[model samples]
Target: MWRIVAAVVGLYRMVMDATRELFIRILMGILIFLGYVLLSLFIYAIMRRIMVPQKLHTLPVHLQYTPGCSDIQCPFPQAELILNGGKKLLSSGQYYKILLELEIPETNANQEVGVFMVNLTFHSTDGRYLSSSARPVMIRFKSFLLQILYTLFFAVPLLLGLWEQKQVIELVLFESYYEPYGDGALSALVTVQHHGVQLYSTQLSIEANFSGFTYYLYQWPISMSVIVIISIFVSLCTCTVLMWVSDVVRDYDEQRRAALQRRRMIQARTTGQAAQNGLGTQRRGRGRQQVGSNTALPPALEETTGSEISSEETSTVTGVEDLASEMGRGQSTPPPSITPTEGSVTSSDYSAGFNDVLSSLHTLSRELDGQEVGVANRNIRYRTGH
Candidate 1:
């Protein structure tokens, strides 16, 4: 079981080491793609700026005023007026005031008086025109409050769109925390038209109207696009940084694991060595015990044999003394019939038998002592050999 676990761990480590470079390459590729996307978006923004049409809030115009009477020889006939580099035109839903200043000459009292009418016309680049009466005059001042209201009508929505674009940019690009809010795409469209003036004559009972031109105004907020591009760029950078940090962390963890494994291996080796040492010590202890038992056995056997031999010698000696006493008593009673020669022969035989018993006891004691010495010597030799 432990072998299987170790094999699995080794395989995992090998796989990680083999794929480490591949993982890094993949991260780098993602970062590159993100950078490419960011560049493409930047180019697109530039192109859009160059290609997209912008709204023109004003137009230039040239105005010429001619007197109606030729015979009256009116002064300042064919007068040219330039307003705002010519005459500026306002878009529909927009209000502006135009102030015109003209110098007139005082007529002499004797000269004949004549009524003159002048025609004032306004023309646009699109071929639309507006004409005034023979003499131009202001009918009345337009409502200042109404003009302000008209200005606000166009201005408010434009301001709101700008504000919305700003908010969207901030939320999408700058905000770290994510939230699902607002529209994904931003767009704005505005349309405006310019209509020419109307002239009415009470006595002639005639009315004239000029054609006017219409322009369409469009505003697209590219800020959201820019935000998306910026977000991609930022995300790529963040991913790169995170990948680096993760790699560092992984390396640190691997090092730590390696250190731990090394420690475990050292511990295992130490423990195994200790076990072997313990076994060796136990064997030595058992060997010593066996030697001691063997050495002690010989002494005990020798002691038992010596005690038996001593007891047998004591019994023999006692028997010998009894025989000698009996023989002495018999000598007093049988001396009358027995000769001295026979008595001498019997004494010699008894002496010979006692000497033989003494010799036998001496031989037994010498053999016992020699055997005990030999056994002790053998035991000592065996212990030294061990």
Candidate 2:
């Protein structure tokens, strides 16, 4: 009986430990998914910043009239051109396409054509202009490769640390079944004794102590390490896949909602007169409320409620009527009158009373048996003899 009790307690502890681990893993998975999403968004933003086009400052055009095309001779023709939003600031070491448009009025179309040479100039924010020969030149900035390399270097350690922490958690929960050896060394250490000669013996360093505690570290077996690595990779992959599935499901749900909305809109449009009369609106509102109420419960709660209903149904099967019947016919009938025998009853009479009590309790508990009935008979006979 004690062994059974101990086993039950141990099983309960294991269940609690497993439950705790499951919750932790679930929370970690959520956090990992969120981190992955944030990282993806950050990378996308960076790529967008790198790839977006940057516009340069516009160049002013100077028109030089020919000798016969003075204001009085040609009345300098009027022209109009519309340009879109102005130039954007450009980063150094970037290449951009340059476009120049010239519009000449029809009135000067027959005028003497002169070779028009225009000089472009670029001015820095510090009031320094580029030399004439350097017009249309490319600007150079520091290379981004070094920055990327440094980022990767930092990220690798951070990722490794996270992986290590995950492995430590797994070790604490699952891989800690084996106790340390007599000398506090892990099981990986091996020792052999042959004829009082110690052979092939290895021990951990014994000098490491901090704050009254000694710390011993050992390398995990290759198989265990590989398993841990694979498990971590698989878990991360699963989380990513789940994230993608959730996104897809969300999008599908949105589409479904949109389709439903469109259908409702179309229905309302088709029944515009009815809707204006207020009957259709009231019907639709009632339907929506019913649907919302039906869907409001979470899936977990739904399952729990379903289980509870099933349990209640099962429990209702053993009703009070059935229990009263099982208690014994004596419960509903009067007890038989016992005749006096020499001013005393035999042991059999006492045993019969004990059996009746046992039977009643057995019916109530549904677990008592003949073994307890025999034990009660023996006790009653022993008392009667004494």
Candidate 3:
């Protein structure tokens, strides 16, 4: 019975361990999925809120039903028209050919919807003359999954591109450019005619930016001024950022070159000192053997040299002590080593040399005494001979 109870308890513990691990794995997977989903949602919300509205405002209003609207006399509800709004002439017993364009938003119906009757007419101020003319048009918008994706995809870029859409309208004014009386402003007459009837005729006055003049259309100033301001701001910001980046790169390059020069100087000094001490160590044979047997110098050299050292010779020098221990003691010393003869040093050497040079340069930082370093009268104590 004791044996049976022990086996059952062991099986229960195994099952509990497996269950706990599975639960933890599942939780981790869920968190990763949620992280990606939330990020996508945040991007979508930002584009929809700030970008879409701006694009809609600047989108060109294409007059879909304008050119062939002469035969369209049937009344179509929910149809509207937009014009230059600066015309002023009308005559009796004449019809104006008007163009109308319509845009339909997305609908749930699977089949395409067709356009109905559309027309345009102008009423004179005398309440006696009225002219009307129009044409039949068919406009249809397609629906697909890709269309929805495209709308989302282009929504943000389009918004940013059109964010400063100050040049929203490019009107071809008919003879609407002239300066009058050498004084106030420029004035000209413009006319719009349809079906042999004048729908709009007006005299427009244009004011210059610097001159003391006022004109017919106020919309011109709003659009042009806003666009100019935004363009200037964007240009200034771009130039500023470029200047800042260039300055940073220049400063960084200067510091790097200075550091390199300092490193080379310190390395030359160290090499001179090492050579002068009669300790011109080589990487082989009898001398290494004696040194290894007496001290742990070989491994320490390997560690220090390996941190910044390169080349086959450097590595061999590092392994010299280890090799010496392998050899029998009391062997004769090896030949002298030489510096590298050719090719530029590696980036690794620069990094290594940086550390060594920095340490040496800052050595005086730890000094507690206030003695002048280079004074002729000072007791310039030298370090002990290596």
Off by over 4 Å in 2: 1-6, 50-88, 108-110, 131-386
Candidate 3 residue-wise lDDT, 1-386, digit = tens: 99999999999999999999999999986985566556545554553333222111111222222444544362222222222235322111212222222333334321233433334443333332233444443333445775677668778876788432111112322122222221311111122222212111112212222212122112355564445445554555567689999999999999999999999999999976865432222212112323223221211221122132335433453344334343324253322232434664344553344334233223322221222221112121211111
Worst 10 residues of 2 by lDDT: 165-174
- Candidate 1, which ten residues in sequence have the lowest lDDT sum? 165-174
5 Cα displacement, candidate 1 (Å): 51
Cα lDDT of candidate 2 equals: 0.37
Q: Could you estimate the TM-score for every candidate? A: 0.24, 0.26, 0.19
Query: What tens-digit string does per-residue lDDT give for candidate 1 at 17-47?
Result: 8799889999998988877786767765665
CA lDDT, candidate 3, residue 216: 15
**Which has the greatest TM-score?**
2
- Score each candidate by Cα lDDT: 0.38, 0.37, 0.37
Residue 135 in candidate 1, Cα distance off native in Å: 33
Tens-place lDDT per residue, model 2, 1-386, is: 99999999999999999999999999997997677656555554454354433323343333323344434334232211112215323433333333333332212221233222222223333434322211121112223685466457678676777422111000011111111222221111111111111112111111111111011111233453345445555666788799999999999999999999999998988776643445434334323322222221111111111112233433432442354465355554323444546656555654454444434333433421212222222211001111
